[model samples]
Target: MQGVTVVDHPLVQHKLTIMRSKDTSTASFRRLLREISLLLCYEVTRNLELTSKVIQTPMQEMEAPTLEGKKLVFASVLRAGNGLLDGMLDLVPAARVAHVGLYRDHDTLEAVEYFFKAPSDLENRLVIVVDPMLATANSAVAAVEKLKSRGATNLRFVCLLAAPEGVERFTKAHPDVPVFTASIDERLNEQGYIVPGLGDAGDRMYGTK
Candidate 1:
């Protein structure tokens, strides 16, 4: 857990419990994800560099702290990542967006990318990659690698749940990038699913499979 930070906020834990329930409806699950993501977003960006800017207040002129440098980029790992993306955008309305489309090849549980689109100025921005689950870390690793290839030096990975195996692999693969998650589950099942997890996140979020 060297480079990982678990949000563990009361609101985040409460909503995650509801999301983990099998009986939760798709609409409810999606809603909870968006809500929890806002809290996670708060924690993830907590250390963002701040610079004071002079602004005029009704009473008088004052210097207010504002985010420094270019706007941050939220690079969503398509589909499930969008669940977190929606709420993150609500919190950081000025942030830019990026999408990296990848899917697991069932046979190998490896990521296969089909599409990618990101801002032209990646090196100048901080990119946070969002994906709901890090069961195998295959997709997460691939997505981060793709972004690094495109000049994203300052990057982070955010997910709802992560398995110990996935976390170890991810950290070793990209130790420079920090990870944020709601929980690190017990372990991953044989089929590459997080044991006792909320089930397939994308499936539960979209009512598929």
Candidate 2:
């Protein structure tokens, strides 16, 4: 609640509604995800500091504003997170990218990491961790933990949808990381899925089971 932001722009809401429909095709769902991710990126990076730079225009040289500090690092939490990553890259082409591959143990519902690779200078950059659904907060929390351990300090979490339980758990686990999402659903189902969610984001987006 305190550190969460819902991107309620009309375009974001409209695309989310389209994504939620069970009838939407896999291709359509992926397209909408990319589109909405751009909007989400806008909100997540809203407060990035800017510095003035003197540059030459077609007609004259003048001072212009540009992002301050090192290029941001966008850390994607495996397959599903890549859906959001593709779109975020569209908005911030210069930003660095990281991948954290984690999967939930079926029985235990705990996150397990298989792969992790990020920029060496994470200490000097802002890191934005992304996953489509923050259902249990297991993967999201684990991913952020890994990033922090690797020297990432300034961090944010962005997702397409979040459950109240996941948000509470995530915020409690990482109080310093702000969260950005399109919607916060009511609750998680017994299977750790968000009700009224867009189904399994990975499945719908990639035609997986």
Candidate 3:
């Protein structure tokens, strides 16, 4: 659909497998996050506007296409999203980064915001709200809502993996924004975890819980 993209890249699948394994070491998990983020970046920027520019090459002058419009803002959804940010930055080094922290309450399953910071001119730039695991969609939806409230008009959501339930909820909540993920698994478990999905991305990345 227009609002969702399930990336079929082989490398994405390879790294995702590593990330999903329960035995994957913390350092490896961190590395996989970075690699997957870079892969996601390629798909995310595929439709970016491009304009021709004249530039002098080593041999001669040539007209080359360059990205157009305001630079993108990589807005990481706190802890887990931070792991995705560094790799995306490698693809777009000059891009600015914003941080939004939201934690799902274990009891209520509600998204709680502890920190939020973004570019003041977000309305003119494309914003990518990133997190590795989009499970129930509460944190992700809340993050996007908060960004819209802060004058963000152009927006895209990126995550390494997603649950089908999360995808349905997120798309229904904000159909106008596109979401890019490496994989979408089965339904969420009773504890709101993605069934057979990577266990607690936040914990895997940080070695906590």
TM-score of each: 0.99, 0.98, 0.97
Question: Once model 1 is optimally superposed onto the true structure by TM-score, how far is the C-alpha of residue 184 displaced, in angstroms?
Answer: 0.4
lDDT of 3 by residue, 38-128 (tens): 9899999898999999999999999999989888899999888999999999999999899998999999898999999888899999999
How does model 3 score by TM-score?
A: 0.97
lDDT of 2 at 176: 98
**What are the lDDT figures for the candidates, one per model?**
0.96, 0.95, 0.92
Candidate 2's residue-wise lDDT over 1-209, tens digit each? 89999889999999999999999999999999999999999999999999999999999999999999999999999989999999999999999999999998878889999999999989999999999999999999999999999999999999999999999999999999999999999999888999889889999999999
Q: List model 1 lDDT by residue over 155-200, tens digit each.
A: 9999999999999999999999999999999999999999889999
TM-score of 2: 0.98
- Which candidate do you rate higher for lDDT, 1 or 2? 1
Give the TM-score ranking, best first.
Answer: 1, 2, 3
Candidate 1 residue runs with Cα over 4 Å from true position: none
User: Which regions of candidate 3 fall more than 4 Å away from where they truly are?
Assistant: none
Top of the candidates by TM-score: 1
Task: Name the lDDT of candidate 3.
Answer: 0.92
